[model samples]
Target: MRWFLTVLGVLFGITVFLFLDYALPSRQTVRITNTYNRLTDIGANAIFYASADAGTVQNAAGQRDVRFIDTVRPNGRPYVYRNEDTGWIWPPYFKYDSSNLHAQATDRKSTSANPEWVSVTSYGWRVSWLSIYPNAISIRSVAGPDVRPFNWPAVLILLVLGVLLFMLWRMWNQFHERSIEPAIRSADEAWDRIDAQADAARDRARGRVSRWWDWVRGR
Candidate 1:
């Protein structure tokens, strides 16, 4: 049981880490290679894409227009992102600036050699097997690829999340120590008292009943 519990705890921690890593917005300073509209077929891969814009219609159709930003990382690696409005869904990006972001990306486009570096803040991941790409939330021009952007947003989010988790831990500890442990202890004491009473009653009736050795042994 101890081994099983330790394994379960490790798995849960890894799962939470991966979840936050993908859901939280991260900033990357890279050079925009290009930007364009991708007529994507959204079948089972719809969850990877964002919902329709606030006023846009969300049809049951299999295809939709998704904008993509192609860029090369600071370490000279290519990165492709799908731009879409989150439409008040998971991750709570509330990003409704698809067109405006596209324009900004287009304006910031530069070559790999010259590298007009920009900081792109985005959330989500690119799973090549699932054909899903990260959604770029915002972008701004930076000095160069080597310039590291200070992630105050991520820091603030972590602080809030840490405080929430700490509060939850405290609540769980209080509930267990006050309620669960006391309940279990009371139950154990009650059972012990009942057992003692039964034993006493058996002793008191032993002489009142006429029983030979054979009867006592249940002949």
Candidate 2:
């Protein structure tokens, strides 16, 4: 039971960590290479894209026009981002300015000879297999590709989660010590008393049998 609980806790912790890592906002400093719009099929990766009901533009036949911004990191690794309004759905960005962000990205576009650094704030993961791109929340010009903005929201959320887990651990320990252990000990004592009574009754039955055998031999 202890091993089972330990495994369960580890699995739960990993799931929560993954969920937060995906949902929390993160920033990447990169050079804006180009911006364009594409007619995409959300298809199997619909969950990664915005919901039709909560998006500014509804998808027809699981297809929509998604705005994309191409970028390159300082190390020259390419990254692509999707610009869309989250509307009133999950993550609560309440972003309704996809067109503005697209315009901003287009304006910031630069070439390899002269790079314009910009910080893009967004959430979600880019899984190439699923053809999913991170949805850009906002973007702004940065001093350089090395600039990294402090993530205060993510830090505070982690701290609060830590505190809550600690409290839950304390409560579990208290309940086990005060209730479970005492009940277990009482059950053991009761079983021992019952065993003692059973042994005495067996001994009495044997003595009665011996007396009847002695009477039959004397007759």
Candidate 3:
């Protein structure tokens, strides 16, 4: 029974550790969308500078525009960019310059227009994937599915409770085992002593009886 409790305690500890490991990584992924936005903002600023001379535009800082365009993957699933700053506000046919502005799949490939100006914005969107990762060639957007935060406080509480319970059980077991040990030893010793005394008394009685018989018989 003691061994069984010890084994159970160990299994509980292992389960807690595994849960923490799995949960922590997923929490990190939740922050990925935010991180990607920061990268996109940086990329957008860079494109703004590269697109035209800073002096050419009036109210350059205030008029700066950023939008995210919703696009479907090849699998026909909808994934809108989390950053509203980079989405497409207009249809694909709207021309940025002389060329029509079509929704291009966000990939690493360089999609440029006939005129370099049109390509400037499109290329900026395309190369924005590079900002996500320094050496990444492909822009694979994560499925913006619902994600839950790792309930760290709850986990911590559970761990603490489990540890306390395990310790209490262990201490109780030890105390009970120790409590009975001395009583068991004392009882065994007392029984042995009693048996010895009974044997001695029986032997003495038999001798006395024999002596009495001899005296009586006068043989």
| Model 3 spans > 4 angstroms off | 1-154, 173-178, 206-219
Give lDDT per model, in order. Answer: 0.86, 0.88, 0.38
Better of 1 and 3 by TM-score: 1
Estimate the TM-score for candidate 3.
0.27
What TM-score does model 1 achieve against the real structure? 0.87
**What are the RMSD figures for all models against the true structure?**
3.1, 3.1, 21.1
Across 57-108, the per-residue lDDT of candidate 3 in tens digits comes to 3243434232343333333343333222222221111223211121222222
lDDT of 1 by residue, 100-196 (tens): 9999999989886577989999988988889989899999988777888988888899999999999999999999999999999999999999999
Per-candidate TM-score against the hidden true structure: 0.87, 0.80, 0.27
Q: What lDDT is reached at residue 194 by model 3?
A: 97
Top-TM-score candidate index: 1
How would the candidate models be sorted by lDDT, starting from the highest? Answer: 2, 1, 3
Q: Specify the highest-lDDT model's number.
A: 2
Task: Please report the TM-score between candidate 2 and the true structure.
Answer: 0.80
Higher-ranked by lDDT: 1 or 3: 1
Point out where model 2 deviates above 4 Å.
1-10, 56-60, 189-219
